[model samples]
Target chain A: MASQHTRTVFFISDGTGITAETFGNAILAQFEFKPRHVRLPFIDTVDKAHQVVRQVNHVAEVEGRRPVVFTTLVNVEILQVIEDGCRGMLLDMFGTFVRPLEIELGMKSNHRVGRFSDVSKSKEYHDRIEAINFSLVHDDGQSNRDLDEADVILVGVSRSGKTPTSLYLAMQHGLKAANYPLIPEDFERQQLPSALVPHRKKIFGLTIQPERLSEIRNERRPNSRYASLDNCRMEVAEAEAMMRRAGIRWLSTTTKSIEEIATTILQEIRPERLEY
Target chain B: MASQHTRTVFFISDGTGITAETFGNAILAQFEFKPRHVRLPFIDTVDKAHQVVRQVNHVAEVEGRRPVVFTTLVNVEILQVIEDGCRGMLLDMFGTFVRPLEIELGMKSNHRVGRFSDVSKSKEYHDRIEAINFSLVHDDGQSNRDLDEADVILVGVSRSGKTPTSLYLAMQHGLKAANYPLIPEDFERQQLPSALVPHRKKIFGLTIQPERLSEIRNERRPNSRYASLDNCRMEVAEAEAMMRRAGIRWLSTTTKSIEEIATTILQEIRPERLEY
Candidate 1:
């Protein structure tokens, strides 16, 4: 238990410790050393803070080493109390993060309180985007569905994650998402899907870094018409032009995770569908 | 904005801020008065924390009132700095929540420094459960070609959100998810799916609060055998007993949102399948 190799991180939050856990996990993934995690959720009072501090002190004493603390608190005084009692390092989530946003929003110091509605609304929008995308892939061409059915509808050339993205959207957001592949033929023909044209407002085109596309294609078939870099560039450019001509909005899927891409699309387009 | 009636919350975290936003939104949903939310993700340094504090101050100025701050920080000293700078109420997310877990685990407090190996392991266990449930649903009397294709599977009495949950899983996880409904006839005959019985290790059952089920059923049918409280209870108990007999693990879905239910199941049954 008292090894020089392992460190313990206490991830605490005002409500559920999930936020700290999620973010902390991602950061930890970036590190080579793995440490232990202690998560505590739903702490809104000073008494709770004191109890937690005592625990931290006990752990430090047993381990014979000072530990770092990563925390999110809703009360300032409670944090002070913990700091006074606990000798180890501590991290405050809100104090370090929200101050700038408050300034940007033109609010006074410590003026912002409570949960932002935008976050939930953004989630809702993302859900809708996912639903739309899922519906496009799994449409089976049978049912005429509502807008809520979409997670995201990706319009782009071959090799984009349209199919996989649509599937991911459905699996992640419970959205009946779908996708439509935008082939070179479609670009040559200068036609968008007839079904999508009416919902042009909902359409979002995906463009990739042409080099990446070429590399991805080369894996499937080298030196072929489909895998040529010049062809990839031409197709991507032409697709962008077609989207611009059609007055459809679009995003670049290059150098982004599926989650990031989906989240950005949801935030920018179809934001109304979000519950928050 | 100067609205005295409203309260504001700032949700600050060291990473994506999604978790804080999620739980915060849940709490906010309980209030009729919608509070303004400001979120800062990826606060890895004390400098970033200072920047956030400035933002909170600005919001306070704009609102012309002191707002409550709800924060999740990784550095305790930074929390102190923000508290010193701000006049509004402060809520420290970590001090309030995770300190106890450190004691329970008998581990030292290491701030913003740990690996979530346990979480990942738990996620793997959850994924296995979901996988088995998915297998039972999508078996389809044909060849079970891809067991890895599942995101989750739900086994329970009919009308337990099995189909909807399967659809949600498929739509959300890109998982070729499936659901196996326990029919009344099957319950009366005291039988389990022969195929599922073989893969009992993967099975997960869903049971609902009888009253809740009755209310949900009452919406579809004013008066019917299917909607009766007595019948619902009997079916629930019998189904649970059958699962226990088969050594299949299960969860109750009563009063949980589909998102909450799905998330809990995914976390408990298929922790390994977590994308993050």
Candidate 2:
């Protein structure tokens, strides 16, 4: 179902190309068109660069127009090969910024192929791995052994999008996130879970629209009362009321992506811990 | 504990600022210096822009040097406010490329506060959530109910980095990834687990150095035979031999980040499927 105005977009990088995609996506968001994304990663050699240029040219020929290519390639010779061969609107993501940065800092660019920090042996890398392990062990109230060590605790009703958000916080931000589900029993008592009370300052709540919650729960456990819209509505109401009573900061996940939810939670609960 | 040569770097955006950080980190890696990273997200208003400028200037004054600020703010007025007020070397992430993009595309930019796609209701968003749920349910050979649906299946020995990589593949790439541990039983039996045989074409292997694997396992089960270096070496050796016999593509996770491993796997097994 290709549209008449569909344009091909290529993300090229000498390393993982994730940075190229992230940067290119943000820039492409301003335009109103469908993009067919193609990622060419690990393009460090001139041979690969020439092959990439040929592929881009092929795509341009088939589409009857030049593709928009974005590259984070650091090697000048390899980048020059692509620049000389490709027939597209090429954006040099690194050259555009690295040149200015070098001049501003009065230093020479390292011109390395992979520009990611040497994190394999860094303390920050180990901390991120530990955070990932912690979040997994603490996922869905699986463990309370290290509850006190959690950077943030998330409480929400089942199917309200807690586990994914918890994992995202840990994986992306190096934060130890633990999540607990707010069940009917807790709602009957009308209090924050006892295990979470001591860590109340680090607690955040997530709520989703009842309709969406029901839809999600139905996929997990169909034809059950727990998946009924009425049940979802009642549970959501109780959870919201409980959060309000406990003075917990909460946001609706109905319209927010996992990135948005995690970012918003960090801003509210741990603004100072926002560094990666 | 700041180094004398430490410089402050700020990532500001109207959205999560993840893109700004990702792009900035790549560029910063070219230089050799410690950076004090700061992130300011959700800066959609002029007032927040003013506040950020003040903060950047204050950092420049305290450090006795100008801070390097990276911004993905899309609003012209807010961007102008920061450009006029800040004393730091401001790198307008969006404005630097958007102007030329506008001319190339023959259209005016949307200039929206948040540049992220409208993923709240898109099928892509739902697919990502589904992928996350699928990965969790199938993690570590937890279930084989939907093994056929997985886009990639990972096999490795215990503590060789399966669960985190599986979860990352699902979260970041929207791929349904399932991981299974290659235990002594499988090695002795000289075959993969029965459940993974049918999905052989989609199978990938992860191996780690025995010493590193022992260190990781020791943290979980201290002084146990399973965490001993001798046992780790045997398991790793047998696993590698089995993978070579089974003709499954494999990589070492000893010195690679999750991003590097995941990207390599995608490039090897599913290059055509690498799209957001």
Candidate 3:
């Protein structure tokens, strides 16, 4: 339990620091320790790098232990400034991998500061922005104006996590996702919504445990009939039955993260749509 | 332009493959070659690993070039299967760093298959879901009920990238962000919206180039006055003048991605709120 002592961890980058954080957190998860995280992003200049080095050294001195610093700086001078000055152990996320890649590819790295500026002008970026706008307009079956345009349409009862999944699909994967809540009316009719009938080929369903459903609904409408366990059970059962009769693919969201749910949906509906 | 010949790049992982894709993309950005990406996620077992190796080897054989593979499998058996069997260049993302980390920390990694399940149950995940719901309700000045509870309020003209920036802040950072559009009413009055005046300290502004704004608006309402360059110029000038007179911090979103915009907003309004 010696590693139980909380240590300071820095995820620093010349850009948004997102890559450093993602890679650093994955490595840190293996250890048995608590991390006091400090994120220093947009450190694209040597002056900024020097400032960060001072901060890291000050923290290392105060903690009486070497902090762990994960950096994704591509600039040689800025990287050196932090590497030489910081008292903490530096885990160079980019430096560790870029050298081998450069050798393998027989090319030199552009070593650009803030790479997203170029990405923002890409066709993929435009598609992602368009997908986000599409999802926003189609959220909660708000507007069925362009149902055919959706790459996938999600159906679930209230509080079944359809909205977040749809938005995450759009935001992360650049897929146009529209979500429709399976209300009592649809259950009574035992059919898909009128607007969604033509798009049954792209329809996916999500069901959650009745207990969890009630718990979530309770947060929005406490002690109401809509939040009652019986109501949730009936809704889920009805929704599942409708999906089964329609031969639509579905999964339970009670135990999955948003990313997991979105990935599963992609795997089932459009395996080819998976992208970085 | 020999490097222009597209090469296959595989980002394989035992979990969602998000880490592998993120890190792989960052490294790949440094190179000059165009990659034909293949993401094989949820490759948990030895059988899945073998299956992936076959596909990668097949691609290598067909392409007559060694494909580059990036992996984040934590299981020793599965990782060994990949590293030993694949004919392509294998980059073990976990193995490359975990050993040094284990030496530094003096502990073995748990080597769990899927890491996000635990994270999904954490309080941070719940807060993220709540923040998403909060951002949804507070989007576009739809609801002002919880204005005081927000960490930041983004104000911008329509199509100025307020909603996506607010949602990204909520989704990535677990921060409650509300965004409101600055309409002609506020511009004519030369005053901040009465609903937002009380929360002045938490307000940030985003402005886009008049030309870019018109282009975006044209996508929605082509050939309308709202999409005219002159109208856009007037509105942007008015909004900027109002923000300057009110002493509110602002930035131009003309050249920034959602991540860049969100990170900049956090850096300006709540520097202490940055997280992994």
Candidate 4:
């Protein structure tokens, strides 16, 4: 008989799956054979839980391994489905983590904690949640129409942190921020997005050193057009030129984290539209 | 004949203004009045630097206050611009923060440490930077088509750690993780983006409780449509229904930080397209 396979641990959860993923990854990183991870977010139903079990079984079959499912499910019924279906280990989210909190607080089993319920009571926490919300909704080219609705707009070249910056703006500032990439094509055309041109006042650009861009690009597509030095330089230069001509204010996204970019943009743009 | 007024504080920097914002906000939070903020990100030129000064002046004029500018400019020359234009207190970003860092590292003035500049030759550090780049490009609805191009994709509701999760995925996992908001509209339509539907295998979902949603929403709009409990319940239910019918795999966005979400998504999704 085959040796009992090392358990394939699934850090499943109902939401972002980051917590289980982080603790799970940290634990896995310690081991030589990284136990497999199967995370299922937004699993708020019995059917979904059943589906997750099927997927777990499939992964186990493919790897010829018995897997331990670590999950954070909001609905209790789904947990039952997962426990019943899977033969390997199972870690239920609420049961292991949240239940203790409920017990400690003496709150009901289904006590929910989120921004709206807690905002009036906690300004700092609310601001962080708002910051996260603002960041998630704000995207550059795709969400340009929504740009006007943003508290800030982050403009940057590829890999210059248009996305994370946007997230930071949302997560930290409680400001709605949208980000748009100053793509090679957009630069070649020498035009800001038509929507952005009118709102140039709100536009903030992010550029990084060509060398930095090269290093970042090299990691993805080494020696390719997407990550080439010449291409990056051209894109950066053209993007800068376009920002200059369009009169859209901009910033450089070189060495900063998302938090830095978002805060800076919020400070600079100060969009009146964000007066919620 | 007006008495001297409080100065507006501007935190301008080359990259994201998180550190400056945090420190600045911490200091400001100690104060009772809302301090004016002018943050310029991605500052690579004298012109942009000049614009920031102009904005700072505008704020001062409007508020009838001399603003204290807490800035982090990458280029020293930009500092000169702020100094020339403003009469308020100025805290240079690099001068204040990096000075300590430089002293600690025994590095020269010219030795600038940036996200692109590898701090150490450690694989972990290198991976973190790569992860940040990946998250920057991967916005859910805006850049989901790029999902196939992404190292990972994050799915979640508003404030469910999608943005942070994406950033964490990029900053830690070196995986390009694009995120999309599972909005009420999308759920009401009972459809995922046409693009995401096909990439169901790669999609992840994040769901938080309605009460939590209400808590988050109430902060922005005290009693608006967004913050309504009924709306929250409806949206969460719809999003879950949509996710289930699409047969797209998902994760919850509740009770996790950006770090955990990113890591779990990376392990579970494990997209074929990785960034080097």
Candidate 5:
């Protein structure tokens, strides 16, 4: 956000411009000023770079302020066009980091463009997609046919956010996440599900504040025992005890987001499973 | 990668160091430098900031180079500590973006920390989770019970990478993506499945090079007609013809990654759906 004066900022990249905008905004979000961002992607040529500079200068003129430009162009010739043409501050992401990195590694960079996060044709990419499919198919313990196939299995009472948390692990972390919803029947048995028994080492647990669980459940089903605080409290207490008895590690989701829960679980269970 | 001279870099943040690392790496990718990155997260208090500075300064002295810092600290006092104590270039995401944004927006920023990209309790966050769930249930045209509920339905020959593409859409863009595998039987019929007929407008088609499809299929079902190049070629050709006749938009997955394919489809179909 621009404090008293709203200014335009451009995220210019030679490829997707995703890196420029994503990283640039990381810095921008800390600002008091609000920005009107214009993204210019696929600026792979000098002509395209020149065109972007013209537009950037126009924004600066109209706004009566120099617009900030965050660029990730690896091609120095094109980057020079922006540096020379644009009246605003040109923060060259590559230039700032490349020289220092080259000195550190004692070798020249490959000078590749848009190679950091390409996912179309790599084994790692394929593995992540496969992991995501695994999470979806095994969700809510719907099928035990492949319970032994999971990297981490999550168990929690209903409305404790097992599904979303597992999906986060699969989507963001590339981990095979399978979640099981604990019901009264499980409580009655006072034992882990038969299918989960063989894979106890991979199990993780989620618990939530009973009051929050009630509110979340009430959104889906109101005035029912399932959504009742008393029922939630009893279920949560039993579920926690169940996890403890099984020696499965557990975390409370009462005040945490899916990201936090997934990250903590991954850190404690399998550190190398996380991609970024 | 820091080239010859390996140096230590720190991603300093008041909350999770995710933004700093993600964006920092994007810039660092252009260089040949192999950086030794150390993340310092949850530096919320002044005391924590002081401790981090000591560690950062230690790294600088040990390495005998000015360590590069990518910081997302919103607290000016903490930021000042790093600027004054650390011997490095401080890449302040907030410092660079905030003042201009403040002037542009004509309002002082709330000076809050860890506000951007909070996923735990937002409606958009919940929407993404719901979308992921919808994609799993509606996958492979498994059910027509809620075909009309989907934002987009992906149709493709098996092994053409339909499942992963749809899931990426659901996970990244909050699209309720449903995919249906087009089989040889459907190719012979030269029409869409009965379930997809009424909602033809929501369909997007994916086709891959037969050779690539054959290789992918080979991995799934070895030495079978399903994995045959001839079968893959025939199915892909017929699938393309059917999609053309049905007036549906389509793209080739031969040279594109899932991100490119999904992003292009979204751009042509629903450009407004993407957040960045």
Candidate 6:
């Protein structure tokens, strides 16, 4: 159950306010009380920062409580304005880390406003978009002919976290990722799918604990034999053995987030993927 | 061409380091110079923070200059340790935002360690995973039968940014997003696809400038009607008219980033999507 007492939280950033809110929610989720509400006000300049401070002041006054502000303002002047004008706690992200970084790095931050995809016209943005389109068309082995263009091919049983991992690799790393499911027949034959044999070197296998797999499958098709723990155990065991025999590198997705899984895969393969 | 003058940068976060790096890179990209290198060290405690301070100190000494740090640590003890231990300037995220938040929030933050997806079994974490899987399986109209379960169905012509936007909504917002393409046949008929009739309330249309759509499609199928600007323009015009006549809400993907597009869709539909 949620707590009765709640606090208002604002995640203010000069950018998307995504980073501010991510850390803010992560912190608030740990408290005994839930936040009364949360607002993400993307404040990109001194003018906007002052507007946010006023909003924070208004919220504090109206709620009869002090409001919580989590901000990622990079400009010292803008930050100063908020800190000076606001009557609440200001958790400034750059203030906390930038100075220490400046001392450690022996350089001053350029203090540029948060950069977003306004660079959609740029090559980097297009490359990522291209990769996503490639991934979508190549998804679930739908376009086998284009498989040769993929930097990585992820193969595993249905619902072995292949799709999200593929998309993650595409979105974050700009890698063209194509995924194929190891159907029951492939497990029965105890072989990698024939379409993948030519590109064996690029294949990465994903495995999950049978029990967890069963739980996930049950969510999709409850009470089915496919979701049975025994069936999941057998299929996963067979898939692992097949990949092992083929000398394909594999990772267990049982306990890994998509980020961890994607990072490990990137490290293992080193596909000249985009780092950002 | 890459720049010659460069410096080392570190993205230190008690959590995933994703947000810190996103902001860090955004700021860095604006400069004429490039980072010599970047490091992401996920430090979770006062000890780890101190360790980071030492590493940054070592980098400064070895490089004959201080290192720039972009960080998102939430605890004061950890921040204090890093600030005191390091010989460099400290940019404390929480140091700036938390105090302002505390005054307004009227309560002390629980000071809990940042919990990332490594604590992988949380409900909120699983919701994102589930949504990703749902989106993947339902991607590009893969399973028409399950369309009833989708939070939103993104409809647009091929190469109009529907897939990536749908995937972004799923990955970032824990939204079960299914996308359908408006094929030439649908345009010829000047009507919504019959399968999408029942889900009219949940449909969101994505449109792009014919020039951009032609460019994107040309990358896939060069010198063809599919990639021809004339065809793209005609198809897009017809699709827009059809969607407009059907009262389907739509957005242009030409000028906006995926983040911008997803945010607008969320605001328009309010599909119970997760904010963080």
- Model 5 chain A — which ten-residue stretch has the worst lDDT? A267-276
DockQ (0 to 1) for model 4: 0.07
Query: Top TM-score: which candidate number?
Result: 3
Q: Model 5 segments beyond 4 Å from truth?
A: A1-10, A31-40, A45-69, A77-92, A99-110, A116-121, A145-149, A222-224, A273-276, B1-10, B33-69, B76-111, B115-121, B274-276
Q: Candidate 6's residue-wise lDDT over B1-276, tens digit each?
A: 023434566777765566566656654654545655444444767778878888788877776656666666766677778777776545554445555555544667666645554534777678888778788777777788778888889999997888788888888778889899999998778888899999999999999999988988888899999999999999999999999999999999887777777876886776334232
Tell me, what's the RMSD of every candidate?
9.3, 2.0, 2.2, 14.3, 4.3, 4.5
DockQ comparisons of all candidates to the true complex: 0.11, 0.62, 0.59, 0.07, 0.31, 0.32
TM-score of chain A of 6: 0.85
Please provide, for model 5 over B1-276, each residue's C-alpha lDDT reduced to its tens digit, 9 standing for 90 to 100: 234456877888886666677677776776666667766766888888888888887877777777778898888888888888888767776665666656654667666777434454677667776787788778887888888888899999886778777877877678999999888778778889888998888889999889888887887789889889898888888999999999989988876666667767776666655322
lDDT of each: 0.60, 0.89, 0.88, 0.60, 0.78, 0.75
lDDT of 2 by residue, B151-180 (tens): 999999998888888989999888999999
Q: Which ranges of candidate 4 are over 4 A from the true structure?
A: A1-131, A251-276, B1-126, B132-210, B214-276
| lDDT (C-alpha) at residue B181 in model 1 | 72
Q: Which model scores highest in DockQ?
A: 2
Q: lDDT score, residue B272, model 1?
A: 47
Candidate structures ordered by DockQ, highest first: 2, 3, 6, 5, 1, 4
The number of clashing residue pairs in each candidate reads: 114, 0, 0, 66, 45, 46
lDDT of 5 at A163: 84
Q: Lowest-scoring 10 consecutive residues by lDDT in candidate 4 chain B?
A: B111-120
User: What TM-score number comes out for model 4?
Assistant: 0.44
Q: After best superposition, candidate 4 residue B177: deviation in angstroms?
A: 8.3
Residue B2, model 3: Cα distance from true site in angstroms:
14
- lDDT assessment of candidate 5: 0.78
DockQ winner, 1 or 2 = 2
Cα DockQ of the candidate 1 complex = 0.11
TM-score of each: 0.58, 0.95, 0.96, 0.44, 0.83, 0.82
